[model samples]
Target: MSTDVEINLLDNRWDASVASGMSESELLLYRSNVLGSDKRVTNYGGGNTSAKVLEIDPLTGEATEVLWVKGSGGDIGSIKMDGFATLYMDKLQALKSLYRGVEFEDEMVGYLPHCTFKLNPRAASIDTPLHAYVPRKHVDHVHADAIIAIAASKNSKDLTQEIFGDKIGWLPWKKPGYELGLWLDKFCRENPDADGVVLESHGLFTWADDAKACYDMTINVINQATEWLAQKSEGVAVFGGAKHESLDVDARRAVAASLMPAIRGFVGGNQHMVGHFNDSDAVLEFVNSQNMEPLAALGTSCPDHFLRTKIRPLVVDFDPAKGNLDEVMEGLPAQIATYRDDYAAYYERCKHDNSPALRDPNAVVYLVPGVGMITFAKDKATARIGGEFYVNAINVMRGASAVSEYVGLPEQEAFDIEYWLLEEAKLQRMPKPKSLAGRVALVTGGAGGIGTATAIKYLSEGACVMLVDINADGLATTVEALAAQFGGDVVRSVEMNVTDEGAVAAAMAETSVEFGGLDILVSNAGIASSAPVEETSLALWSKNLDILSTGYFLVSREAFKLMRVQDMGGAIVFVASKNGLAASPNASAYCTAKASEIHLARCLALEGAEGGIRVNVVNPDAVLRGSKIWEGEWLDQRAGTYGTDKEGLEEMYRQRSMLKRSVLPEDIAEAAFFLASDLSAKSTGNIINVDAGNKEAFTR
Candidate 1:
């Protein structure tokens, strides 16, 4: 272990000038944000920070000691002043008299609201007492990876002594509750000289009478552990050396694309689960390692890590060296079934009389032998976050197993935490999922007005959307706008031409890898050409057909491949035009292509019925506003064919309509949404005209 090791120490971000005029509570908020900004300091929404400050009581009209700590379910990295739960110190201290020992410590949670100061709505976290009883003005509890590595080590206590000597004390495993709070208080009192204590199998807690000192100590302590680990673990084989070499980047993604849809099919039986893929260096190192299976089986030690990542990861039976992805795909069903059975067995062995019933037996984290890691959850964000937690677990294993033996929380302990009633209550409080929750959709021509509108509609209802378009610039803008509104995890864009056979197939694979599998396909990619039969060039006819008829067929063929792979019923909604049914004087090519689109839908619906893949069409008429097809020559040509100017064409169509109304892209989007959603589950091979009222285009 004499190799040169470089350590990137956590920066002490606190500035004297920045801290000069802030109130004590403000300083705590500042410290929490800075600490949480680094994942090495703490995982997202993990850990707690607090400061006991004197505030004037609104009710009592007296300066009173109030405990302000990070609220439940809030991330400190982005917490605001209002994110802290404020409780009266005297009321919190009084709860000790109400405590009925460790067995009944959970009941103490019921009394927390009674201690609320000024009727603050933000609920205090379970770790409230851990900070409240610390007897310090400021306290921070963080799940810094370096510290947790030491805490999760088999010789955690000895390692703590070796690293920091008596400056930091050690506490054996105790699930956070009223009792652990008391244990923390007693330890601080007994060891007055200690700056912090490392909670075994959990995290680190550091406190000081001043906010800056507390923040400094937390960073300093973690940095010390990091430096020490780098020194001790240098030149040591990481994760028992890589058992398999990582596949090339393209090959890794190809494996993921092949596997994700299949895995998603099995796991999404309970509910549709979106997927996330991680091929980061850290993930690749662990997944390719000899110790990956053993370490993963031991599960994650930290509560936050396990809470999101589950008790353990499912190890995919893939051999990267042989590149036996086909064999692995064949074995996935049994592998998944085994994981579910194992999870059920774990539940049966560990359940208490009042334990919450077994949760989704599906694995959250999937470790491939060399490709990388895959995670599936009810949504993209959760799936992505789950992968992040597993990465943290990998980091912990790298350090702990290198120094000593890495130990996960005991099975019984992990089960208790997993099935904790408090955690169950929190889950029950979550809002009901939206209409399209957990479903993934791909919109062709997605950068266009109709495509963008449909995407927004689906996203508003909780669907993850993959926007596909030939327009790279438009796709990027649309992706950015949608990501800002719905979050980056749920929105993705692919620059693809629907008529290109290879591009279409690649886009389908990309969709599967991006969001598990496709549940909905909005075939809106099209072109319009207005010309009399004699004047219409063969090139124009072919161009219209290639983009409209041939493009839809290409996209649908790929969609069917993925849908069939998933074996999950899917919806394909074709955004054809009203001209499909109604013949105009000069727009033969445009009308014929649209008519072909409708016919194709009818054909697909017949073919897909047995497989539960519903195909439908939405025919929009005179949708001049925000319609990309009407932007250039088509608009002028349509206006000339209708004996009107460009601006007058919409009015003519509106006046001619039975209901006399203009059509817009959003109107088409609404019709498209209905056909794609479960709302139209029983209806297929159907056409909905979003033309205000076009009797000629009406379905018979």
Candidate 2:
């Protein structure tokens, strides 16, 4: 409830630097980072900042006032000097005269670019004009959660007035453009005493002659709102305990497993999709609250959120203990159809002549009682961002509900901003996303050399991967390394025996829940057993078949079932060995088991081809550098057979190949990637040899 700003941290970092020397632009960049680093002030790329500074015009070599504002697609948290787009202040100010009823989408957007100081200044932020119009050297804007909670309430104007007195002006939600900028300029001119402006249901804006003052003002205003809300809800508990208690963990997992595939299929469309279940304490509390339905349907907390979360979430009815998934499945299609129909109607009701084409009408967030929330998107990043936004939204709504009824922007108003060309153009300006951007992949024996390499390859191509292995220690180490490289959300680990049917099924279910659906399965789990047929024990032969052959079958069968449910074609790659095609002495058991794995892939290819599911195999040989299989007795045995030390054995195997090259795990990984990707769209039931030049193992 304290309305104090944390100015000490800034003082510590800036006091000495300020005394020495700091340019206006550098100070602005430093302040922008400070503001953006706080999630309470800005979430992701949701805010903009600027500083008006004197700069020498390149052509004239004379000092001129310029407005440097955060550029489009630039994250304030990590922005640099180049991150701000520079525009001539006089030229931008002169644009006010031309805004005589000129619509933002029509002539104003086209004119703003002409006022830039440079030929092609970094695409100026959509709110560039708002900053230019604010009569201050430094300006900071943020979608502060505390301010949002108050600004989005039913009586926001009164609440804002009560908290900030007449020192703050209130502007009704207006799509950011020329008109909005002009209106703000006129308002400030009239109400010179106001320190800032609150855009109803949008965000807050504060400005001052100094960067520190502007940042301090932002924190102070947000703190005031937070304290007011805290005082109002001191003793009142708005969200009562759940009327329907949460189901046990086991039952919840079962419910998620049963319901996720159908939901994934219904919303997948043609693009590969993934789902993430967020069961954090906040999410669970929100889902289980007595007023969950009404508060959730109220609408998104802000207009920008619409682009990511849609207008409202889809709320499904479920009694965790008594609900029948079959019944839920039977009604799901109709529910989705209705959701789409309603969205289409909303578009029809709000569409303007210049509005962009309607986007697909699918709910990005799903609220299920006793199971928490499920956020869906084409890729993991978007889904995770959407999930985080919703969690913030829930908190805002909860706080606002305790003070006053939560109110979002009007539907027509939201539509205007959602389809605004100025906003839509930002998305178009982005580079094309990766091919496997939103797909989920599962790899068995993911701690091993070939499996680890293949997982990294999939991650590099933008797929979220789940690494399954029975080696708990190795799995933990591998997952930690990969997560550090590709972000923790993009990589996950599951320890389970692929040969265990129950465990494999559970793992597949976990994958589906963690990431919406499985699109790629790499059956790379195997054990190397070298023994002559006569010397091989019944246990040794059965063990090889169970892991190398049967394990592949179990994992593939589970993946195929999920892919079939998703109805989206998937890819499966089996890491077999060159010995499968050409038998090796003292490796009878290993050869037979690998051969069984190859045939299993072929049979799967036939059955899966009709469903657009591709099944392929990669045959690799002597990948000893990183191979865990080459450790201990296996290393000594191979070296002895080659009549030299382990080091010499690697060279001996390399020279045996026609190419005289060492077969590395990365080499096999490359082939697996091609088969997993669309590069092999027309290919299935094929064996790609990763061996350098094994003529005997070549698939002819």
Candidate 3:
């Protein structure tokens, strides 16, 4: 092996003091978490780790050896003690006696539950048998990119020998199941001195009689392979050298922002898809390379990679040298259509008699030359994770193609893995998606009570939200709180003044790039001013009109432009006020501005009807609690006007309502949720009064 390459290698993170105190099972969890923390070791949900421990059998009152392994669909990086499935070692070994042949191996999964120890409810993954029959106290199966680079080469066996000598063994490709598990046991029996093996077009498996030893061996083996590949491939041109120069960072992002929404529209024919954009150095290098199309066409080599990213990505016909984004936009629909047809053809050519009915044929990953990669999926995190996996594949291809011919998994093999009956069964067990699972929303004035409440409601129902506010500090606090509740992936914030035309347009672009596109806009940014007609200053009147009427128009106009590009109908909910309809004695400017907001919704409804866009109004009255406006001078002014103090103002408003109930931010949120959801799909240009029975604001 060459020694010229000097690169950052994987660090051995096992602290002796820490490991000395942990129990055997806790050590397994600790080892798995550390390995999973770095994508260089394994991609998310792409590996399994296990340890055999002695436990008292609940049924027989005797000490027995049990296997503790990661459960199905659990990510090692975030898994807890409950995430592991425990099974009796004797039963798992005895399963070999029941296995008839490779063809009937899938039936073995049905018996895993029967082997459960202590009635642990976690379902064992298909990889359980591979770990079980290894004949070692600890085992780790990880899809490391370095090992896969060697595994995916045309002469992978030769490369494996050149890198690790006799320390690690090799096995040919076999779809992971009971049969593959037996193959591993047989390999271990034959190669007694070997510490691990690399599976062709699969992943790496390492074992040790000690828990820490297994982790050390796993990390050491991967590091060795990575260093060797780097040395052998040093000074080699990546992806056959770049075919197109990379666009400047700003231009690349602009191109991605332009293409994402249109592509989202085409692929979202069945269900809405959130988008993720990646312009990292690796992604830029690959996308701007000469071999990008051919390598992408080969699809991913690992089953885990293809399972997240579809079989292959769709290569967009974009050239940064020409800078013809408009032309690219015009051709996106046709390009997307061709991709679907090709995917369908692949399914038809490789499918078996019992393959699951054809799934959504749309491509998950999209490659734009000279810009970056765009991925669309059912939700934001999935889309972003899919991009990360593709980047991993890019790394593998770069290393493999540099030293040896990079090879993809056979088309039939990839199809079998994707459409396997076992995989299909797992898919069927997933929970139904939430009502707004794939939708994205932007709430203006999101730092305030009503805006924050509306965002929380949308996020609860599975929508990605972009919170827009002018208060920098408040926006940051609100974003931090929401991110804590709903993860940072689904919540984003932008400080923007809705009245500025330029700010409104930039916010729209940011939303497109942030979450693919927009599906709902809750126009809730406003201020409350209480002054008699004589006392109201020109400045106060202009402020109300500027923020309430003109601001709403600017935001809606930009939203319409973006939604039109997506060609998917959207919802626009205007949070007007009950005072817009009921004339108050001391607040002409506030009432007139709000009335303008209500009328704007009516006009937008008339114009957006043909495009399937629905516009509606939610009129709220005396929302005193949890409202930023009510916390300021507006509270004192309103209390003075009604002859009540701050303490009694809420009760005064409650008694004035016909239903004698106080209005809160949550009430407005619920109303906004209805208008934005399918519950009000058929109703447009309508008003839902959430004032606890305000006759003056009634929309009859």
Candidate 4:
């Protein structure tokens, strides 16, 4: 079962070049962002970041002195500038040396005479000294899933030596912060040349002169551990061999939900859950194991993981052979009570000089026999984070031991960090997503043909869209075509001119903001202008550009800017004519501008992709509908100029295309919405043609 080949870690040395003039916070933040990409070193909250500030931003004129460490609560993956806390070096140093006391919460808060939390906005992380103690300029820490899996094994300590020979250093899992730092300081001093260090039942740490170097070292350590685990647990057992006939998934989730408060109280929100209980004779047998004391031995892999995954998995003893739901539910409360009591006792024993009592835990995962794992979150994201951590932890533990014995960091220590006030406060200031639910979007050119049909399609999907046109009378009539199909909010109408930027921007911003941020923006505003090239005048050219080309750009640019900073990305569609693709006579400026409009969409597509924003252009053949281009005055005048009746002129436009039928707006919106949804996560930078196979398919 072992992999064919394993990679050996080559990085262990610290290079001076890696410590270039970056702020300690910047370097550490940089490290966390890069390291989070690795699967083994961390999962969600499996790691932390830090840095010492050598200088202050002079322009802000704020105190030039401070050290900002990763806040008490945050994911290492997207840790931001505000994610780090600022503290006065003097106060932190003093607190580190504090002894037994009455737990002066104010003393800890006030200790930073030079650092003010509220005034600075960024508070410092509690484990500040752990970073300060490292003589190296940068430090990277992680709950290396592989290393911990191996380290936690009774055989791992010796196995690590067996596998790596001399490069790996093992530290018995110690409570992190000062004690761990002191122990680490001594070890580093002893083995100045060791390549990497693994914490027993904890994670791994690798630091180098640069971000890539540190990242590469973490990957190397993991690949080695992965190979080792595969060798050891080649044919280990998995959960769910026996079925719990009576218990369903929901019943298990319900029982866990009832008991979650005890586990959740330690962490704030987003708990990892796993339902490992089985109707299987194995789980029942294990629950009844003379050696298996689920409560006493179910500690987690590391203390840092406490925020997402509580100290233990809820190991249910549902009998596959027998036992009803009521019986299992009846005993769950007692187990929950035990978890709470253990948490409280842990706080009393491990709390240092002056931290406040713990808040209830945030999230705890359960291991109910038969039912699968279920996680709880303030929202779905955190729940998944916590749940994934526990599931991974269980996998590693199972691999680490021939029969792994649970040994997590002390409850008191886990609670100290999990309840750290400095951590909770940092997670508060982020923009939540706003993807318009139960709201309507009103597009002016809804049905004539292209715009109107497009609007109809948007209505088909969930949006309440108000379709509009210069021919308000026609739009009202199409309501009958689309009426009784969905609720009234699905579509609406308004008469407006795209040439009026103020009115357009105001109308657009108002309608969508009033509804919510606009989810889909299709600026298919235009007019089809045609005249003999020699006779075209300044007046005609100006009107065409103002209404057609310039109008679409103005609307699209505004939509782009709105979607860019809206915090969540959105989709945009432009309805360019086939004329925009090729060229038509007497229409010099119209062709030039339409071509320019296509370029505008292409540029916005490039810039907005960074924000998950998508820009798409749809080209359609001539459509005789609500579009002013295909409407009365101009079309008749152009037809007269062409020496043909309106019927003949219409046929002239349709017959030119392969699909003889005119393209409708609904057809355009269908293509637009596809690019807007989850279907197009990888479909950016492309133009979609709802045209009836008119142009040769040349892709950009």
Candidate 5:
């Protein structure tokens, strides 16, 4: 549930012309659209809205007063004078100094009796403290369909981070009452200047000194989210249907006009496209779905849905020869069948042998060929949101056709995204980085120094990171350190040898559930071997491949499955040693495995691109993590073979770099962060340098 609104929330605004001594220009009527939009963004009883209403404080006997927020059940478009709530400005500010996030829902509501409470319009917005938390006169909180849909996606966190940066804090979904108020209280205290708040698995909050700023920010957030969503969507050329779609200006306007009547007629007047699904592929594929209801689940992803078409849209897939209504009337049953069949197939493909699958799709929409597909929801706004969503789903489905091996989310994983309380909780705790929130990220050998650093970075960026390693104590230590900071839910640690397939799969599955789905995976776990060619036994060769190469594949396979189903792009990075790109004598086993990783990243990068999954490799040269690189048997062995002192051997490594400074684990962590951030949004299938300049000396 969200309290934000779409553009038309002002359509039925109450007239204030009768009031005397007040300027009509400054009255809320001037900002009618904004007030109305505040109510259009959320679900049934989902969000709250408010406005500043001038009143005299009877106690102080002052000439002027404070903000009057919307009461419970007050629709923005139809709000009356009594619907606005009165809040003493000085008192509200006083509450801010408490430095706590506890909600005063009842406490605040209870205070109404003290000041013009009876004359006060409606009950105050449930989020009065939150609204008061904002230093703005106008405040809105709504579950916007576009933003929430993005929030609901696996990449929403990652994408949101990229789009919004630190400007907004992500509150993982928590129930929207007192507890969430505490969460917001904490967040506001931390980020005093944020213009908004993004509720993970929920909606968005936008406020301003004036109603217009509040309104525009709402539109801006949705529009930005819509464009970002478009880019992130799995889009492709149309297939198995009409190939030519060249309707010029007149035709385009005509189509929009034609659809308006039907859409408006069914829902009510004032219907509009808050954000339209206009891509050719999206429009084409969705219009051609065998069953529109199943296709409709993709329509609207979050709370703003109720504003669009209520909760979900009804499908009209069959021929509408007797006008569109005849077909819509008849296609309902078939649409349900198609939706059921698709869900069943998805369940069968992703089901583990143990669990029984649920029957209903999280949401649904549909239609027969030729006739336009309808997005069904309980409201107009959600229906419109659904229109774009189902189209994106179709585009991904078709693009996956090229790979012929594309798979959807597993039943349990899908269930997790649609209903994970923990995920919702994450929105409350972490700043939702549209880029990485709700994503399951794995860092191999996470117990090892470098792996631990990578795991921590991802967790900080709002990802569910599973740190894996063979050393039980090391894993415990890493987990303890990370959990203390990111919380136990955001960071998980597992002790398992990467070489075992069953062990790897179980670990991946367990980690995936804890985090929701896999998105960013870093394969940094590997054992090093320095035996010469002649001394390298067949046993050693097999062992190296087992722990290094085979291990990489096992982790990669499961990660690929999780990413593919979510339909959100994923990133996989292999921490191959510099030896893979160059040469190292007496290091046959280690070099082979390292080399294999480079090749694997390349091949997978090429193959997975169609699915929007990016693959890259990090070549780190002699990075120290309290390891023997600085002073120990490892460096001693190399120095002895080179007939040089420890200083001489260390210089040998540094000379290979341009900077001549030893690479530290922190340096590698920074590089990993770049590859995983928007800083390199367009990069993939590439190798990044974590080395000084080793490539210049050794060109292997």
Candidate 6:
């Protein structure tokens, strides 16, 4: 194995000019970013980095050595200087004396805060002491997959010693605490030539006097381990079986569509939940391996991953040939019951007096043979995180299996970290989630102004959104933008002409499968038509009716069917227009179609009331600016009707409303959000005017 250090990134965009005169803290931030940018080094929030620096006390004017370590809940990839917690080394070292005879679960947590040099609100990482005790100027710690692949193997100590010789020290599995720090301090003192330490079933720790040296050391150590595994596993197929074959996407989706809802209901407790499907090649290979059941029974690759993916994932049998969705659904309750029973039993065996309340017995990742993986959480972002961590776990497990056998931390040790008070406190300190945290929403006409705005609003308020539009290109752009703001898993795109009954049905089925089930539907897709009744052709009239009126009915019918199947009450909001309630010249087709849409909402409201579904309408007027409906010939014709230009028509409408504010796509979106959320639980068959203040279109 070559130990040469090279920084040949595919995209080496880091500016040396910008980094030349950086402060010690800024250099630390840059180094951490470099480490975090590599997924092979660490997953999200899975590692910590620190630098020992001299800081003059503001009050005393005395220089003291301090450790600035990555704080709790901070992502190293984009972290700023404030993301680190400053801790006094003297105080931290003194803590060892105080915690000498103290139990790790009881006494170590309270002393962590006292070691803080500055009274910052951010809590220091639980591994802060480990960083402080290292006798080096710079320290870098990561749950690198290559290192863990070796550390988590059945013959970890032997494999590690053979790979790195005495260049690295080894510690048996120990939860991160004062004892682990003391052990590391002792190991480094004894093995003065060791450049790093590998924690069995945990992670890697590398240190040097300078930041680059430490980082290079990490890369070198990981590369050696990876090279050894590569040589050992040459021509050895990791996954092989007759059962492993190409998966049927449609059949898997059908199975997911049928089984996810039941799983959602069982795991959701009182709150609703959403599920995301992951069929990446890595996930599929792991799920399809003949040894999948045995491999999955092994715990998570590391203890840090326990909070995202539970100790072990739940595995369910699935066969596309049998197409026995009902059988799978029938067996889910018992399977989940057994999972819960096993979890509770594990807790009973491992619980300490200081252990926090047992978390809800829910599986984070689900593995199905011949199908893909499904991850469930209270919201989309968390579900994506769980899915991502499981993918990483599979890679690590595969590497370890290729060498020898994959073995994770023992149950008791994992429990110690999962129920650790320090980790639990981080979650407790987070702000309360948004009202629509676990809800799912579908917005049609999503490529247009109103649809895109409504999707953004729902996402901001913490709802997973499905953007449906007939324009494939436009829909892809919109979904990409929203996914950037919210996470990609929280926002998705579906292409369908809402007027086609078959397309609408398939879209609804896909949405249900994608997000477990639906809760809110925004029927906002429509186009504008401007002509006098004498000038309007049959084709134009029929086209407007098919999309504006009939399309709303088709989408609502399909959405309502899924809502009823889930037995979960949902909301539907129809985007009509001010012309629907009032008369408008030269817009006979558009006005007529919108009016029909309004009455159709009312009829559905009456029928949906029995099923606890709320249906309402929002009438917006003259929202010309981002709207494609008022562009091109339609803009000129509407302006000509008022004997002025388009700008003049906009000003006249803005001045006509009581509020004198221009109605926008976001304005209609706000009204739609209110109707879709629980704020309007008792509201149905209602028309909210989003036209600034159009008294002429007001409803009694």
lDDT of 3 by residue, 568-684 (tens): 999999999998888887999999999999999999999998888999999999987777888779999999999989999999889989999999999999999999999999989
lDDT of 5 at 699: 39
Clashing pairs in model 3, backbone N/Cα/C closer than 3 A:
none
Off by over 4 Å in 1: 1-5
What are the per-model C-alpha RMSD values against the true structure?
A: 1.3, 3.4, 1.6, 18.0, 22.1, 3.7
- For candidate 4, lDDT tens digit of each residue in 81-173? 778776655455556566233343323434443454445665444455565455454556777666777766765567778777667688876
lDDT by residue for model 2 (627-661), tens: 88888877887677667997798899999998999
- Tens-place lDDT digits, model 6, residues 1-700: 1212222222333556767888777878998998888877778888899999999977689999989999878888878888999988888888877775536434675777887776866788768878888999898888888789888999899988999999987899887877788888998899888999899988999999887678788878877777777777666566443255535788778777766766776787768899888877778777877777888898886876777898999997676456556788778889989999999999999999978988988788898776788889988777877888888788778779878889977888888778878777877988898988899999999999999899989999999999999889999999989988887778888899988999998888788678988899999888888998999999999999999999999999988888876767889999999999988999999999999999999999999999889999999999987787887888998998888897798998888788998998998989999999889999999999888877778897
Alpha carbon lDDT of residue 127, candidate 5?
58
Q: What lDDT does the true structure give each of the candidates?
A: 0.92, 0.84, 0.92, 0.58, 0.58, 0.84
lDDT of 3: 0.92
Task: Summing lDDT over every window of 10 consecutive residues in candidate 6, give the lowest-scoring window.
Answer: 1-10
In model 6, how large is the Cα lDDT of residue 98?
74
* TM-score head-to-head 1 vs 6, winner: 1
**How well does each candidate superpose onto the true structure, as a TM-score?**
0.99, 0.93, 0.98, 0.46, 0.44, 0.91
Give one digit per residue, the lDDT tens place, for model 5 in 1-700. Answer: 1112222222333334533344322344334334454433443445566556556667667645475665655555555555556767666655545433433333444444343333554445445666655555666776555566555555556656777887766777664444466577677778878877887656788767665566667767766765554454334232333423334433433333234223322222111111122325346444544433443444333433322232344444334233354455444446555655665665566555534434334223433344344443322234444654444344333333222222333334454333334323433454434445444578888887788778767776666677888888878987998888876546777777888887787676555333334568888887666666998899989988987788898888877876664556678888887888777888778788888988888889998899888888888887754442234555666677667887776677687577888887777877787776666768888888788886542434
lDDT: worst 10-residue window of model 2: 1-10
